[model samples]
Each structure stands twice: as C-alpha cells, then as structure tokens.
Target: MTRHLIYLSIMAAFTACGDGGKAPVQQDTVIAATGGPDTLNRMVLIPGGSFSMGADDSTGMPDEYPKHTVRVDSFWMDEHEVTNREFAAFVAATGYVTTAEKPISKEELMASLPPGSPEPDSSMLAAGALVFTPPHHRVPLNDVSQWWSFIAGASWRHPEGPGSDIKGREDHPVTQVSYLDAQAYAQWAGKRLPTEAEWEYAARGGLSNQLYPWGSEALTTGVAKANTWNGHFPYDTTTTDGFTATAPVKSYRPNGYQLYDMAGNVWEWVSDLYDVNYYAQVGNGTANPAGPAKGYDPEDPGQQKHVIRGGSYMCSDEYCRGYRVSARMKTTPESGLANLGFRCVRSVANHGQ
Candidate 1:
C-alpha cells in the first residue's frame, strides 16, 4: 500500500481557488452617522494593541511555540474571506488567469520534489490544481497522498476538477487559489493579504490569547460555531453543519471583531513567509512585524512556503485542530488546495480615501 501510494503521490501537489456565481452588491462606502453611503468593501477596523502572538496552551502546535508579545498597527480587514462571486467579478473585469489555471511550471514542480528528482513527464505538467479526493477506507495519516490528487483541467472554475462548477456557491469562500492568485485579486481591489500577525490579531476579536476566535474553549462546547468536519476525517463526515464541503462564507456567526468564518470555513492565506524559528527570532513586544524574509520548511526544504491561518471544513479535532486562532500551517505559494482561501486587509490611512 505504501509503495502504491508513493507512486500515486509523486506527481501530486497544490491549493484552493473557486469559480463564479451571483455577484453581491459591493458596498464601497464608509460608515457614517448621517445618511452617508457605505463603501463597496466590507471592512472592520482592528485597533492596534499588544497581545501574545502564539499559543501558550497545550493544544497548540510546535510552530506556535515560545509565545511572545507582539503589537500590530491599526488596520481594516475584510469581514469575510473573498467569495466566489467577488473573484468572478475580478476575473470578468481584468480577465485575470489564476496561477492554478496556468500550466504547472517545471521549476515549481522541481522545487517541491525531493533533491535530484527526475524531470516530470509532459502530461504531468499540464495546467491543473490540487483537489481533495477522500479514500474509500481508513488510510495511514502519514501518507497525505491517499487523500490529495493532482488533476488536469482543475482550476478555479472547476474546483473539484474538470466537471465541477461553482454554480450556486456564490457566497462560499473561493477555494483552489494560489497565494499569487490571492495577491493579484487583492492588488486589483486596492487591498492586500493580511500578515500572519494581523490575521491572528484580528482573529482574536478583542480577546487575548484565546484558543479560538470564540474563546478559550474546545470547539465541542456550542452548536458548531464554525464549519468543520464532523465525525471522521478524510473518510466519512457527518456534515453536522449542513455542509459536506465548503459552506457559504457567512454560514457562521461573526467573531468579536465582526469577522465571519475566522475559525473555520477555509484555511486563509497570509502574507508572511513561513520559518520554523521565526518566533524565537522575534523580539518581545515587536510592533508591525512583517515576518521572516524568506520561507523554509524542514520537511521539504526545496519548497518555499507562506503562512496560512484559520482551519478548513476538513479540519477535525482528531486529525487537524487548526481552527485555534494561533494554530499555524505552511504551504508553497504555488500550491492550491480545495480547502484553502484568503481574505484582504487595508491600511487605516487608505480606508476612506
């Protein structure tokens, strides 16, 4: 089984970006006391303050270790992850092609593989994106290849591969988008992807060092505050939240900061490059810290990685408890998965003007 799985996985890798549906009315106005109109972007102002940057609890992961104090300047953040409808509008206006829509680059493919790997066949280099394909029975968690497939013709338009379409999922967070694709959309919208710090701070929702966006309680407490896998993972899901896969971006209640789907829904792209030792290098009470200069993952040193926050619908307490606010995960910028998406942020100075 291991040898068979390895052969199947050798060509597999990538992230999420979804296609179009109904477009929403972009509210481009700012809040005002009088009858003044609102803005097209829905943003919430995050006040600048100092807080613990990572996890201090046992449920935290290794990368979130050595909890340190960090402060972020005030900024405005999107209320929800970018929706399929919004991404569709950007595509229609700019005719932009996402990274996943383009052919898999040999250079990128080489970067992700083990050192001295052979050149890939032309067929494996076709334009495609990573799509989640759950196995029939329980597979060893060590081999992710059992669940992820690299399919040709898979792009933002066809999230689950060639025949899949966004259709009625207009409000669902766009999946299968690479980090570069997210950045492109953000630039066109005059916004940018949030830094890991900013993302975590905003996710805190005025709370300090809480386990989740809701508070320091395991996700088992309430009536499914966020969309996550119920029952088992990568095999059988109960869909207790009424979604077998991606749910509407606003299906859950907003955090204390008035942001929706911060805990679960999809893994959100952040601007920071991933470095295992980044926290140790960060000074106490650092302000407006961007992140490490470059990306590194010891598991795959050949691949450059960027930080992704928030958990996805596939996340479960058993396999991946990534919904915790301080939880961290890293993937190549060129990689797109079925459960990965992103939101944007704007500097305070650029809010009204």
Candidate 2:
C-alpha cells in the first residue's frame, strides 16, 4: 500500500502529534519523518470514557472476570509497534543489551532449565530466550527449544542472534527486550507503556465485545487479515500469515482505532501488573480503568509479576489463544523473549497541546 494510505489508516484510530495545536499526522512518510529515534511521531487518539474491562466468557482468565465497569482517560498510543530501526536508536544512545543476549551465569541457567528438562547443558552452549519456532520445515514449531537460545553476539542488532543484522529487518519489531528495556525506550520517547485496560480497549478498536481487535474474525482466513499462525499449527504454518516470522510493521490492515498488529504478530508489553482477580476491584469504579495496583502470579515464582497481552505470532487456536483482545498472561518484569515486544502511549492531554 502507498505511504499515504498507511497514514490514513493510522490517523483513523489514534492521534499523537505532541503538545500544542499540532495538526494530526495523516501520512506514513510524514509520521516516519517525525519519529526521531525510538518512537512513531504519530499516535492513535483513544477517546477516553467508561466501559466494561473484562470478558464474561471463560476463554479469559479470572482476573479478567466479573466484567465490571471502569473508566479510561483519553490517551495517545503508537499506531504501530516499535520496530528494529526505532529500537536501534535507543541501543545506540544507551549501549544496552537485552538480558537474553547477555551471557547467563551457570547458576542462573541451571535454575530455570535443570539437567533433565531438555534444556541444553553448559551456559557455554548458549541458551537465550526461546520464542516460537514454526511447525514448517519439518521441525518442532510450538516447542521453543528449536529457536530461542543464548548465542554470543546475539542482541537487538542481531535479531536472529549471531550472524544476523538489522539491515533489511529494520522495519520489524525489536525482540528479546525486557519490561525494563521497553520502559527505558518509552521514557526516552517521552511516552509510557499502555496499561492493560487501555491496551485491551484500544486493541478492541471500539468493538463492543469482539473477539479480536477487528471484530469476531480470526487472523487465519487462509488469506491473512492480520499476521498469525496458520496450517497444522505447532507443526506447520504454511506461511498463511504471508510470512512465518514477523512481517514489516503495518503489513496488515488497521483496526477501527487506526492501529496495526494489535491482536497478533507479537505480544506487546503493558505497564499494569498481572492480577487474575483485578476486575473484581473495578466494582462500578470510574472510567479509564487501570489494572491492579499490585501483581502476583504463580508462574513467575517471584514477587509482583507484570501483565502481557495481545498474543504472539505463535498463537494457535489449539495451543494458544492469546490473540484475543481480552486474553492476557503474566511474566517477570525482567524476562525477555524474541517473540515479545512493546508499543508506546501518552496522555491525550499531553497530545497536540
């Protein structure tokens, strides 16, 4: 599609032109030109108001239960996710390497993957954060063992880890970044990560109770409306999403919010702590809802785990269903994975002055 067309889609849902009577960005090239380093110059303007935050259906977790009402303030969120070129600017400014890229100590590696859990022995063999490995190529796709591994010189610059360069992949989202890493980029960009409520509501794109961001339609239609898994699933994708791995940002159509890739492609990190029982706290509260102030999850085995929503490209109807807008999961704030990335948000009051 033409750059002009892309901008038209982006401006539809969000607007983030920055303080003062700034004009809305209505073109792709114009948006790219304004995004100085790690951010998109343009944002989707989410009109704030009250709405139900969780799903009554059992497809979601309990924390998303009770289907209580809450309010959200107007905010400006990135029209597309953060890409390699954008993240590269942050690394250059900070000399930062993702935790997965950094060599793991013998003790740390052993704790997660014991001698018998199919985990490769020797931190020397290299074990970085593993994400999705497509079922195609006659390889085990769902099992993360195939792709994610700690290889020396594997960082954002080397996305596939070692032997890889950002060259042509500059348009793809940067992977293996931790929550802290995402926050750092947000800070540098003069923005913040969207809270879980805002993230889901925005992902819904104004759909009252739709499954995915673009209504009930699934990403897999054998034609690809959004990037997602296809074929035999954890065994084979058939490249139905147009590409096995991630495609360039905005490769698909935008939602009502003029936002792209909100439901699939990669899991975007949010600022809210993961609380399975959070909605119960809403209890007819004001609109512009925020997630639980505190977070805890059995999966993390630590204190205060954070929430991550919007499933990854690895999502499958049989194995994974996180592509749904209300779908959510929890993980450590320090964890990083190649299949996971993030977007940015700012208050609407701060936008266009």
Candidate 3:
C-alpha cells in the first residue's frame, strides 16, 4: 500500500505473554475501541528488549542480512490485520477516499501501466483497484500486468474486484488499500503502522536465526499451517492451506509472540523505505534504526515505493519467499492489490496526551 506514498498489514490469536524480554500481557496490550467490532479485537504485547535483527550471510536479502542487534521499546500491535468493518468505521467517521478510489489521471495510467496498454475503458479510472486474484500465481516481479489489473468498481469494499463483498469475511484482513488508507484507519483507531524492523522483530517471536515465523520447516509438512501457493507457478493453486484468496486472520498458528498468521496469509505493509544495501550499514547493539531517511527503490525511482513485509499467499518456493521475518518488498503509493493489507502500532504516551 502506498498512501501519500509508502505502506503494510497482518494477524494472530490466543492470549499469552509476548516474546521474552520484559513485560506480560498486562504491560503493553491495551487496545482502543472504535464504534464497532471492526476494530482489531486483539493486541500483541511487545516487550521492549534487544534482539538480533536480520539474518547473516546470503541466506537473506542484502537489506536483511548481516544480522545486527536492535532494541525496540515496548509497544502494542494489533493482533490481526485491520478488517473491513474497522476500516469502514474510519471511512464513515471521516469521508476519506483512498487513492485507489480516486480517478486515474492520464498521467498516472501512462506512468503505471505498460506503454500501449490502451486507456482504461470505463466511466473513470477509479473503477477498481488492482487485485491479486487476477494473476493468482508466481510471476516475474518485473511484469506488472501478470499480477495487477485495473478492475472496474473494485475498492476496499470489494477486495476481489467489484463483485466481492465483505459479507461473511468482515473479520478477515482488508485488502486493495493504499498505505495512506491503512494509516488513516490506524490514526482513526489511535494507532500507527509498525516499522519494518519492529514488524520483523515481533514476527520472529524472539527466535534467533529463524527462517519463517513458525520454524525452519515450511508451512506444508504433512499439514498446511499457513496460506500460500501449493501448485505450480502462475497457474494452478491447490489451496492446500484453505481458500484461494486471503484467508481469515489467525487461521494458522501463532509465533512465540502469540501473534498469528505472521508468515503466510497476505503481505503486510511496513513503515520503511526500500534500501537494497541498508543492512550493510547496521549499527552495533540494539537500537531502533529507521531505513535510509529518504531513500527510494531503484526499480521505481519516479514513484515513492515503501517496504511491505510478511509475504502473501502468492509466495512460492520457486518465486518470492519474503514471508520470512527479514524478507520484504515495496509497492507504489497509489498501487492497490488484493494481496496487500495492514496492521498498526501506537505510542503508549499518546493514550491520554
């Protein structure tokens, strides 16, 4: 999700102490209430402590390797990704329209879409946001049309293009939103999006040198623990994890942090810029270091792209394996997709002040 520009979202269940470090649930697990059940029902208690951020060697991306010590203060995070009901309240409270819902400027269309890809054939460019359902598989990341489509009438209301509705899945993670949309919802709920380092730290669940959130084992072992592609690339999906689209948050097990669906589900947005070599400059000891203050990905330098964590259902061994704690990707601010969603954090000091 790229809002004003930059984005991310994810989930879990069961109440328990967070990764060992400091406090218990009674410490940093307070949740703010919106008008309805839409608000994230659960909150993870992240105890402030120092842990090794990123992994060592070529096992991880250049940006997530050379694991370094990083210390984060205690903070509360939404247990599950923000749902439709919750976002709806934010929209209702403030008539905030997302960039996806905004009309596509001829300039934007020409800039985002492939050249010669005929102009949008609709009443307006805002017919719908790009959804992952269209591609539904592993395709070369460079090929934009392989995964994204300008569906007509698709918005946050209809995650699976315009035909979808939040009927039985109001509790499910909301998609097709920009980072700004998620930020708006977080602000309205009195929270903020988690930073890339914070999100990975929480997802790792205090485990050192881990690959995925659960364990070194993959989601499929005799049982499907998380939602990801099972079959071939860019084609058949066995749905072994259950459902083709975004599954309800927490359908899988929780990590050491008592946080659910952190590995495979939907790719979550994070508050970090994409710096390919950010890890090489890691500082010693545990310190919360934000990525290069104002860096942009070389791939899409014209548009401000922000980092997204926790790979999506589309990730496969043959393609993207970013579901790991240190893995991440970036998207344009105005880009919207079914595979993208978001969660939030809040400053305890801001609770009263």
Note the Cα lDDT for every prediction shown: 0.78, 0.65, 0.66
Candidate order by decreasing TM-score: 1, 3, 2
Q: How much is the lDDT of residue 250 in candidate 1?
A: 78
Root-mean-square deviation of every model:
6.2, 10.7, 9.7
Our model 1 lands, by Cα RMSD against the true structure, at: 6.2
Model 1: worst 10 consecutive residues (lDDT sum): 29-38
Model 3, runs deviating above 4 Å: 1-39, 107-124, 133-144, 351-353
lDDT of 2 by residue, 77-119 (tens): 9998898778766555555555545455545533443244333
Candidate 1's residue-wise lDDT over 28-145, tens digit each?
Answer: 2111112111243388899999899999587687889889999999999999988877776776656677777766566756554666666676766777776789987888877778
- Which sections of candidate 2 miss by over 4 Å? 1-41, 104-127, 134-152
Q: What's model 2's overall lDDT? A: 0.65
lDDT winner between 1 and 3, please give it: 1
User: Candidate 3: minimum summed lDDT over ten consecutive residues — where?
Assistant: 7-16
Q: Between 2 and 3, whose TM-score is larger?
A: 3
TM-score of each: 0.89, 0.79, 0.82
lDDT accuracy of residue 115 in candidate 1:
68
